[model samples]
Target: MRGAHPRVVLGLHRSRYERRPLTAALDLGVRAIDTAFNYHGFTAHQRLAKVAGDLLPRLTLSTKVGYFPGPDGAPQHSLAPSRLLAALEQTNQALGRPPNLVFLHNPEVSLHAPADAAREALSQACEALADASRRGWCESWGIASWDPTPLPDLIDDTTPAPCVLMVRSGLLAGIGTLDAADELTARWRPSAVWGMSPFGGNAEDPVWKTVDPRMFLQEPTAEVSRIQAAFRVAYDLPSVRTVAVGTDNPAHLQEVLQALDRDTDTAMLLKYRKLLRERHAAINGSEARP
Candidate 1:
């Protein structure tokens, strides 16, 4: 398995939640820990190993690179050969082992781009990764895409092809990861699927902290408060199977796991959807009817 997934591994560089969740996953015997090269703080994975020594053996350990915004949070993606080499060396120090898999985090170019941007970027990244792999920096390389529109374009480009997808499948834009999954269903398959961000693309995660009074007006109170319920509702759609959670504490982790266990039936989802829609319509009517 690859590490550095948005959902599970989490970019622990600066977040307080990194330590506890990483510890929980390790204590549970999870071997893979995803991190990003851009993540600050010295040797994040090494720190994890020091804390959870016994769990290291099972860790598949993955790290990513290509962007970082100065403290302001600006982003960048650079796959230049020398830059990758430097990042590889830093990764080795952090994990104390060669990474199992590496991905180009939200590449600047796309094989699926209407223009040649992604195509060119894909080509350059593939070549750079190949050379890095031979030198023992990584064992494999893949791509992650949240957009469904580009899958076709990526397939058409041949050289340095994408082998995996770190997809954000069903969380947004309906239940279609068509951009990442469909084309790959044929010639290749994904190595890992790191999930992230809770509320569609809006990233409104408070839906998890507590049953905010605001959401109560949108649906049944009981359903609104169930985080595990929301997770199942989110994960149940066939579009999403692999998920990653970035809870900063165990109390939340417990909620997430609990929800994962509660089976979200299609009937329930349909009912919930209906409830939300009816609530919305009622609200709109009351406001519009004068």
Candidate 2:
């Protein structure tokens, strides 16, 4: 089941856990927070968990397991179900509360291994997460991956189906070619689909980095700010149930809200979607269809 909160989720991964930004976002009514166990030396999740303190019940807390802080404070990926279950225990012990949703972070690693081994590993992990949910460690379990192509294989349905799929979806970084063509319709769909990186992942683009968002709405021509164009595309997708934006700057968060609050121009969104589809198809050498 999806939570009753704003469709925009405040991602805590890049927020550095600064009290001011989180408090300000919460004040602005951002009730859903996304974080991971290895983010910022495993401190980001705890910091946000601490800051929310008494208000935890009112907020939706989603986190991921499978990556842990290594000896040098870098990430060490481990998707073993036993390790994941232990991680959840540690997470609860640290936060003194249960997370609403827990995800298997980047289980795509399993696909790189031998086929038989990969299937077993992924299946075991999913089963373990479902067990954790039964024990009240988390309400539901899902898989978060950069490669959505393997989602069908990972979710064999022998285990409990995932409630969400947190993946990349935006303009410029158009959802994968198959997704652009809407070919994954028959796969196991999630109850809540979350999209990240609305700015096309091009940090150096002048339009995304420096252009005023208002310019996109004000311009009479076909030009649109990269951020606005990206956000609009994400908003228009029927599969994406919510969008996650990460920033340490409270002011920027408010600005993002302003962009989201404006009415989405369906005609404009459709136009851009068509252009993006063709562009992506050209790059992939696939026929672009409406």
Residue 58, candidate 2: C-alpha displacement in angstroms? 3.2
lDDT at residue 66 of model 2 (Cα atoms):
86
Query: Highest TM-score, which number?
Result: 2
Residue 214 displacement (Å), model 2: 9.3
TM-score for each candidate, following the candidate numbering? 0.65, 0.81
Scored by lDDT, model 1 comes in at 0.53
Against the unseen true structure, what C-alpha lDDT does each candidate score? 0.53, 0.69
Encode model 2's per-residue lDDT on 71-138: one tens digit a residue.
88788888788889999998888677899999889887556777667777887888899899999999
* Alpha-carbon RMSD, each predicted model: 7.7, 4.3
Instruction: Find the 10 residues in a row with the least total lDDT in model 1.
Output: 212-221
- At residue 285, what lDDT does model 1 achieve? 73
Residue 5 error for model 1, in Å? 15
Error of 1 at 145 (Å): 3.0
